[model samples]
Target: MTTIKNSPRNLAVTVLERINRQGAYSNLELNQVLKRHQLTVADKHLLTTLVYGTLQHQLSLEYWLQQFTRRKLDPWVKQLLLITLYQYHYLERVPAFAATNEAIEIAKWRGNAGIRKFVTGVLHAALKSGWPDFAAVSDPIQRISLTSSLPAWLVKQLAAEYDLATVAAIGQAINEPARLSIRVNRAKASLAQAQAQLAAEGVQTQPSHVAADGLIVQSGDLLGSQAFAQGIVTVQDESAMLAVESLAQVCDLSQATLVLDACSAPGGKTGQVAAALTKPASQVVALDIHDHKVKLIQKNMARLGLATRVSARQGDARQLAFLADGSLDAAVVDAPCSGLGLLRRKPEIRYQKTFRDSQRLHEIQLAILAAVAPKIKKGGIITYSTCTILKEENDQTVAAFLAAHPNFALEKTQTARALKADRAAKTLTILPSDYGSDGFFIATLKRVE
Candidate 1:
């Protein structure tokens, strides 16, 4: 086993290299790197800023870089230049000379004289040229794409659905850091109790405006706190929690109820559902397609002390042969989409996802909904949700579902109250810019028989 020396620049470079060359996910790789190395608070901040900022702005950075050098550079060299340019353009506190010197030093340590010279030349050239004027791009979609560091395809798609100004605002909103929100585990502690516990440990938090059991952590190391370790609180975005809460609002789970989380893995919402159920003798069965994910759900449930309430199962959500029709009291389908809503947290998704991916996911989402719709009892609730603002996946999918199955109707009143959702032909869409949360769409439907 080998370990890289623990320096902010080295750690950032290593993470960036893997992401750029090996197609690694930014958040997962960053967590693994942070756990393996001991870094000071300042270094941790610097490493995170560099990795996310560089990836988020890579497209714009590359567009700028092409102005200076048309030569094809090695991936590592490109990563070095990207981070250097990111600091030059974004981090006003870091002087251009210091950023250039750090890049040169990193190059010398990691590469030969030729590479060092190449890096130095690129940095000097970029500094001399200054930033590109995005206004110079004539096309609105292309200009927004370059300025916001979003893909042109995504920009065009969003622009077609919304006005160009709204698309640009959405793009700009996702580039900023996401706010931290956590769900207080009511089974273990009250929201007020959890807030006091977190405050005693130097972590300040406020109640979430949307979720009844949610608290927004203003500042603190939440993961390292006792509240999190002991399951007094669980890290969850307000939008994700609201999806599960929306189901609870319309469903009658006050008796001995059986609920199903159709695609529950790494079960954040499963825990929320389990805790929100008012029935004393209720059961929440969480199912995932893969065995490892089932285990992950089970492990998360155990940590939150929800294992006894929520059972984990491994099966294809598209085929639930074991459960009979109209057996479940309620169901939640947090279907997989392109993850466009999570760009703030997962900055690399903009480059990785495509419009085609959303098309493919729509089929899968409809299949899961078809399979689970029959499982809910008459008059029971089925909440379809996705972490994307795209209409194709949200309203369009639900519209297709309703057209096929007239037995279920949208529970518009409940969804509006729970999500503060705008009614869009029978569904709700929560945009990140509008809600100040993840871009989530949730539609609650009731089996009318």
Candidate 2:
């Protein structure tokens, strides 16, 4: 039974408007709104497009509409017109007449009966006028920033941090819906075997750039699919799989190596770490700071058929007590971060992430590294990683840790070879452009006893 409580377009418009005006998180509000109604797959897609697309190119739509509307309409009426214009101008499939008609129908709810005619007129005018060329403005950056719907500060930040072209690439990338990638449950089958099973089930996969366990899906909900329920696959991001692969590269599993997945949560990487080891392989201990997430880790381990050797524990990374100093094989400290690198997957992050989160998380990241470093096996590897792109959470935090602990040494990444990096740096910070993946930082270290 479908669970559509309201019309997808109407629900999406209401949600988008409320999110803009009330400062609600789009995804959260969208999910809450969805829960109130049961929608079909097509409606689901439409609603997603209406919400994310409206949010993504809102400034461009508004700027173009402003050039056509004569009288100042109410905010709601203006938003309806903009929504209609977004479809009319940008979306090729939606016919101009249907968009204008639907928008006018929605405008009838407003107090003025005359609003319908005004909306119809403005939409047609904008459609015929065909968007503005704001590049001729005095300051082109502001024009680009608003037209691209990116925060101006972020535009300057990325342009300075990366290059002008890369910043533009990033701005374009964040607006696209994130591609789905699936993680293979190695305890049950190899990635090939999992792919074969999914193929027979009418789902296809491509080999991921990183992680022997990673697969870029062709189609289907990886979690809801049969392969997933049968413990054949897991849903994960390509970059996150890279973080796990980085840890696996450092492991020498011949001996009884104790691998620590510190700060593990939602356990995708934890499952990968456990699956990285072979039979009678090294013991992998996945630890999370919270008790509830321990179950999540355990569940993932079970799904991957790793429950026998991989251990999931509820413990804080700041003060881990179960392991001895310098007595482990390897440690994957996938630290908690501001998640700046993942803005593409979660479009709302551009607005949600603040500098304060970085300042606060820096302390927690440093503390976790210090506490977990002592637990690493002497001369064994410890890979510190984060899903964030900011230098403060990546290199700067790492610099502080290295200064504090002389025993730890910085290591390099061999995978980010194509990154046109000229400046001298000690850490392996993989830019999205480097591997055609999301930006990430992975620093491999070894404890010199």
Candidate 3:
């Protein structure tokens, strides 16, 4: 018998219980557990699948559990049942008997015989009855919420912002697995050179329709490939790579052009800016609030051999006393947002965030823009961006900033022909359903004064 602590099913329960009860971020908690344990590749893959799959469909799993049992279940018991049900309904590769047996073993190890019997009965009953019809739910919003595993508030909010059809599409898209993408570093190699190098190293690639320098990974170990090891490419979503590309359209990257990455951390955008610089004198100042994250930016820069092009610092975005007024040629305000746009990558955010959180982030975003506004030279561009699709955090925040600062004006943003991005407004909002990339918003503001 596998030890309780070593069993993959048992570990999934522990991770899920922590996330459900303590509000832990699924990616962070899951990674932490994986690092602490010595597990085989197959075991790690199973653990990841169980954790993400269960969280992705939690609302529906709980809804199903409610149909079979009316009793208030313990947190662990509830989590165990949820993962078991996820395997039954979603994971067709797993035999039903194997899922049931593994779940019962985990229950017996974690609890007494009474609990074991209860879990066994619920699994048997659910197997016999099959999934409940969501059509029976009367409220359109509630039905969408349960079926999509989105919160009622989120479903309603999306519905208010978009039509029911669009909302339903977004709900369906975010539950799908996130794609793995990497940006080819043009400073070191062209897209073709990078692709050839990656292929020689056993990784396969396909061009991204959303970003010119982006590639959607098809197969093989990207992280272990020589192209990644030697910094010929770096992992970044196609949508995220667009923010810097949009900035490049309005701002010159010639020698001696100084830019500020106001909220850069782990240095993805900062690295992109560095790679786009035309001469050695062109540089980026990357700032983050935490010291460790500042070091992370520095580490990434050194890894990419772009250390000389970026100056990593720890500071708040709302304050700019260290820099003189109108000193920067351009700025990137990738403001900290509610992360509503990253639902496909971080499913737990749908349950963790609220509409009010976006409202509060709006205030902070405006302040950061205000601080960075004075730092940009006349006719300079400030590229504001976020990983959230909410208008309050995207367009509304930009509108509010422009209203408060008459000196600044919104500029039309253009992406590559391949992206075929929406041009209805100066700002661009890319939904998850648009191109299967992380949802993002980008707005360019020019300082005219």
Rank the models by lDDT, top first: 3, 1, 2
lDDT of 2 at 398: 87
Q: Against the hidden reference, what TM-scores do the models get?
A: 0.95, 0.86, 0.98
Better of 1 and 3 by lDDT: 3
Error of 2 at 98 (Å): 1.7
Query: Which candidate has the top score in lDDT?
Result: 3
lDDT of 1 by residue, 1-449 (tens): 22335777767888998987788999899999999888878888899999999988889999999987889887778888888899999999988887888788888888889999988988888888899999999998899999889998898888888789888888888888888999999888998899999999989999987777888999888999998998899999988887777776676555637999999988988898887667667889899999999999988888898888898999999999899898998888999898899998888888888898999999999999999988988888888999998888988899899999999998773442345544454566777787678898888888999
Per-residue lDDT over 150-265 for candidate 2, one digit per residue giving the tens place of the 0 to 100 score: 66666776676666677667666666666677777776888778888898887878987655567888785566668988777888877777666665556654454678888888
Candidate 3 differs from the real structure by a C-alpha RMSD in angstroms, to one decimal, of 1.3
Tell me which of candidates 2 and 3 scores higher on TM-score: 3
Summing lDDT over every window of 10 consecutive residues in candidate 3, give the lowest-scoring window. Answer: 415-424
Task: Name the regions of candidate 1 deviating beyond 4 angstroms.
Answer: 1-6, 413-425
Q: Residue by residue across 1-449, what tens digits does model 3's lDDT show?
A: 44767878889999999997899989999999999888888889999999999999999999999988989889999999999999999999999999999888888988999999999999999999998899999999999999899999988988888778887888899999999999998889999999999999889999998999999899999999889988889999999999999988778766436999999998899999999887757789999999999999998888888999998999999988988899998999999999988998899889989999999999999999999999999989999999998888999999999999999999888886435545668888889988889999999999999
Candidate 2 global TM-score: 0.86
Ten consecutive residues with minimal summed lDDT in candidate 2? 414-423
